[model samples]
Target: MDVPEALYLPDGDGFTATALTIGPWDAAHQHAGPPAALLLRAAEQASGIDGGQTVRLAYDILGPVPVGPVQVRTSVLRPGRRVELVEAALSAGNDRPLMRLSAWRMRSRGDAAPATPLTHPAPAGPEESRPERAAFFTTEVAYHRALEWRFAAGTFNGPGPAIAWTRPECALVAGETMTPLQHLLVMTDAASGISATLDWTRATFANVDLSVALHRPPRGEWLGMDAATVHGGTGAAQCNALLFDADGPIGRSSQSLFVEPR
Candidate 1:
């Protein structure tokens, strides 16, 4: 079989990370986006989630995930017909879990009223946006090459809020089709970096956890984020982003950051 030009390749029971999974911070470690998407895929496939839709996905970063073979373990934490909680963890070799995902799934009610229409207007579409490269990256990186980025407002080199749209050029896994949730998860982790308020050379702002809440599922291949980071006086910060698709607003994502001088 031909090699897959994707973020990950399926191995035995787990998947092996490709160079596309590398993040801007470290070439040896995988970006949170790829792993987050992987965990969500596992959670969705786990038993007891067949009839339900995942409304919330929260991830805790235990450590830096190395770019190599990793395994995912998933199980239903709380089982129910209408509501359920599922957990998935990613680990490499004999080391402890690098990341853990807790997802809440809810079954849809046919007789329930329709969802409230979103009034929030979307940012400029991808066609109207300009192509931009992240200034923090000094050398060629696989993660950067794996996705197409366009800016509607602000910039990757600027310090402030930003509105950007992105889509993966490659699949998440070798032979599997990426779902809409998986596509959204793959880009949500970059909200902090895309809207950095601090200089990248002066200090480092790393997210410890990521929480995403979706009122409705996203559609289409492209996803947009109106993102901003707020740094406190203490060694803490938060990155908030409103997620959107080609249609309109779909959800929101937040990240709790750990700030420190480099």
Candidate 2:
């Protein structure tokens, strides 16, 4: 409805912390916190139990994470009964690791059977669609204004490779409610920078790594992102995604872009 009050906090059993502040669209020189669902809310506040139900989520970008004071160290690593596994690490002091995660917290068992009817290719409804605020990418336009995007073709002006269809005007927190896997990692990396090239003046990218995988968690919240940008020249690039939640295709995310040339 109107959420955004979990800047990450909770350090104890297993661990859960977030202060290495850096959000004006993040990418603090590269990337630190506040995205990827604030490291899944510091792994659901070290899995203290709240909106329970994730199934599986993993992340590893052990490279660029520097801004100031940050810590997240969760641990459960499998306590199956209804399935539970947690392992997080986002240190920023020791300067050794940057990000590492492992999730699979669950406790849902209510499927009556008789469910099979889904479709895809429906992403242009944000009142019609008007996403192109190119102002030299002001932090990717304030992180795409927190979602509700539309660009089912390719035209962010430059970089190359794009296909959009996001949704998240706000709705993802666990301690209360709403958990479509935290908006599927917040729009699954929002259509990685240009798939090929359309001349947005040139191109520019920076995203060391990212990974996501879910397959039967979402059922609502109109989620569906079929991204691309499979490869880029020299500088370095790679993006791939396939996540839908309209009752079909549950998840898949990948990123490793780092292009440059503007």
Candidate 3:
């Protein structure tokens, strides 16, 4: 029998984050990536743009979101025929704010916008890449098991810049189909982990914000992040990743980090 995937079990307007949603840093804290995807889900629902494509995804993590039940509320900030802006907020118990997210969705251009050439080609396929070491993450993380990862360059949680391709090991929500946009959101938030510029043993590097800009929606089940991180002496850092599908570059994602010595 296959292991159950670490994803949400929808409960009305809320969802429960399972063991697979655990983060590497804190046992009680959930990973920012999964919540970010959930935020996108709520935003997409509010936008009511079934045929729309996400052009930008922004996430502001206010604090560590405790694992367990959480609720999402979404609203349309700006309505447009060709474009729309939607916002979502994730709250923990007692409706405490944990994260705020915004997305810009636009009608598909189809052929109006000519296809741009790929500046970054697809890296090695998932079969050719290596799995991240088990010891790299101390605390059990849901993403580690929920997703399949293959590194293209550098080392897994090893050091400087690296590239890793990833795909969902199982559904993000039990019995629910996840969209391409949702998959991209989850993987993009891992920019810092994919490439670390700081020592994990001596420092805590957490992303406070995440932003993704896509020229076109990603295609294929496999998505990759060519990532790099930079840390300043002033306890601040940032990670950037060029995202790709199996074909080629699809978009880009970035995160602002909070770096502090342990």
Top-lDDT structure, candidate number: 1
Instruction: Name every residue pair that clashes in candidate 3.
Output: 20-142
Model 3's TM-score against the true structure: 0.94
Sorted on TM-score, best first, the list reads 1, 3, 2
Residue-wise lDDT of candidate 1 within 1-262, one digit each (tens)?
2333888999999999998888877789888999999999999899484656889999999999999999999989999888999999999997489999999999866688887787554458899998987767644655666678999999888889899888877889988777778989888999999889888888888899999999888889888889999888899999999999998898899999998988
Candidate 3 per-residue lDDT, tens place, 1-262, comes to: 3465657888786889887777778778887888998899888878766688889998899999887889999889999878999999999777668899989999986679678787664457778888775345655555567777788787766788988888887677778777777888877887798788666778889899999999888888888889999877788988988988887888888888988888
Q: Clashing residue pairs, candidate 2? A: 157-200, 158-200, 160-194, 160-195, 160-196, 160-197, 161-194, 161-195, 161-196
- Local error of candidate 1 at residue 260 (angstroms): 1.1
The lowest-lDDT stretch of 10 consecutive residues in candidate 2 is: 14-23
The whole-model lDDT of each prediction reads 0.87, 0.57, 0.82
Model 1: weakest 10-residue lDDT segment is: 137-146
Off by over 4 Å in 1: 1-4
TM-score of every candidate relative to the true structure: 0.94, 0.32, 0.94
Model 3, residue 21: C-alpha shift (Å)? 0.6
lDDT of 2 by residue, 77-123 (tens): 77665667777777665636677778887765566465556665445
